[model samples]
Target: MTAGEALAAAAARLRAAGVDSPARDARILLAHAASVDAARITLIAPEDLSPDIEERFVNLVSLRAVRVPVSHLIGEREFYGRRFKVSRDVLDPRPETETLIETALAAPFGSVLDLGTGSGCILVTLLAERPQAVGTGVDISEAACLQASANAVLHGVEARADLRKSDWFDGVEGRFDLIVSNPPYLSADEMQNVQPELQQHEPRIALTDEADGLSVYRIIARDAARFLSPGGRVMVEIGWTQAQDVCAIFDAAGWQTIRVLQDLGGKDRVIQAQMAEIGN
Candidate 1:
């Protein structure tokens, strides 16, 4: 069948299965199944699709109808204007985490440490954008570490990025000019009601700390001073409601210059703090 005919059929199937934006999703899925860009779909309308490609598109539409996330199906996601491979093993990169990168770049830092760097989006983007900066990304999951390393290579920052396997700071052994993390901070109750797409598809370990949602922050706040050069800063992505509690953690850790930056949605989503003085 022609590409346009396939899109129409896919759209009807999606609508029948209760998927929203059926037409749009159909177009994207069809293009992807054909191994072509979505824009190419419009230009190549009324063209023949191989039997195998048509069958693959039909299968994808069925999956989308069941609410499987498109990123999972596509095996990659675009973040910060670059595409990063993704999987069920990592949390899909969120836009709010870019605030961590922005705040880090603005700070007085030449090197960075990204703890719990799942897909290496923040670390890779930073190294790609800042020619002089080098960074290390640590993750507890070996799979995540490998994925982050792959992203580093994909973005031409492999030489500047060190991907390590560790839980938090357990295996890390040095100081950093800046430390950042978007660690799991979702509380148990919150996870129970998270978006179906997230809860059903994204890795649970990447979404929650499996304890009080703030465990990762507490660990980072308590130990970051040891890894941070004097006056070196740390930026962490937190849950929208976590600003106060996270600030308290930093305060108790003796960090000063604590600041919370909001995302485009005006939600306080990133916390920045500096290590304390020796005498303090």
Candidate 2:
């Protein structure tokens, strides 16, 4: 089949399987299978697919039809203009989390920490941006640490990145000028309502707190002070409706000047909290 015919057939299959954005997913997977940039997919649409490309595209579409994330199938996801290697072992790097990167880059910092650093997207990106800065990324899962480590190597940030398997701040040492996270924020009920790409395919540990979904925010708010340098800041990604609750958690913990920043879509997507310098 020609590229156009193959894309139509794949999109129809994905649509029947309830995949959202069927045409887009089909086109992206086709580009991956054909070993070309997705931007060039349209340019090549009228061309005939090579036999090997056609076979690979068919397999990839089948997996996507079952709701496997395109990033998982393609082995990487772009965040903040950089592609980070991704896998089923770690949460796929998402566009929404890029808001946290933008917030973190608003200031200069000598050191950084990323808690629950699945895939190390935040920490790696920060260190890559601020080349002189060093960063430590901690995740509870060793597999996630491995995945992040690979991305650090892929992006040449491994020299400045320290990857560890730690639960939140446990066993982490040293103070940092910045700390960031995109922790699990979905409640059990909310998890049930998530798309299959999240509920069935993404790691459960990266999706929900399994309780109220605000558990990790409380931990960060309460303990981050101990690890933050004077004037240090903490930023986190939260659910759209979580601004009030997350701000309360930080406020109750004595954090200073809690601010909510919205994503490009104009929803509350990041919580930026500052730590008071010694004595005020």
Candidate 3:
């Protein structure tokens, strides 16, 4: 069949399977299968698709219909204007997490620490944005560290970025002017309600801590002060309804300047706080 015909058939199959944004997903997957830019898809003639391209497109559509994330199917995701390789090994970088990057960049820092660094999107982006800065990213999964390392190299910041296999601060050393995380914050109950794409395809350890979702924040709050330089700040992405609880965790840990920042959607997305200067 032709390219347009194949696209229409795939979109119809996706729509019938109850996939949201079926047409958009189909277009993107088709472009990927056909090895063309998504923008170039519209310019191609209906008869441009070869048999192999048509077969690949049909297989991709079938996988997407089963609720697999398009990013996983494509093996990369765009974050902060750059593409990072993604897989089941790391959480897919979401647009909401960009709020953490924006908040971190608003302040001055010579060094950074990214906990649960997943795909290394946050650490690599920061280092790329600030050429003089160096950063460390740690994850519990070795595969995640590998993925993050690859992304750092892809962004040409591998020299300034260190990816480590650690559970939070376990193997991390040195103080940083800024520490950030988008740890698993979903409660067990919330985990039960997530979309199948995330629930089944994404890493569960990166989605929920199997507790109240505040456990990871509590751990960060209790230990971050020890690893932060004088006047160093900590910023973390949180669940929309978690602003108060997370702020309280940091406040109780003696962090000052605790504040919540909202995303473009006006939902609480980041909680930031600073350590007291050494003299104080």
lDDT (CA) for every model shown? Answer: 0.88, 0.93, 0.92
Across 32-87, the per-residue lDDT of candidate 3 in tens digits comes to: 99888999888874666888988898899999999999999999999999999999
**Alpha carbon lDDT of residue 145, candidate 1?**
94
In model 2, what is the error at residue 219, expressed in angstroms?
0.6
| Candidate 2 regions with alpha-carbon error over 4 angstroms | 278-280
Q: All candidates' TM-scores?
A: 0.91, 0.97, 0.97
lDDT of 2 by residue, 62-155 (tens): 9999899999999989898999989888888888888999899999999999999989999999999999999999999999999999999999
> What would the per-residue lDDT of candidate 1 be over residues 23-87, giving only the tens digit for each residue?
98898888789999988898777888899999999899889988787778888888989999998
Report the CA-based lDDT of candidate 1 relative to the real structure: 0.88
Q: What does the lDDT read for residue 65 in candidate 3?
A: 98
Give the Å error, residue 28, model 3: 1.0
RMSD of each: 2.2, 1.4, 1.4
Candidate 1 global Cα RMSD = 2.2
lDDT of 3 at 227: 87
Give the winner by lDDT: 1 or 2: 2
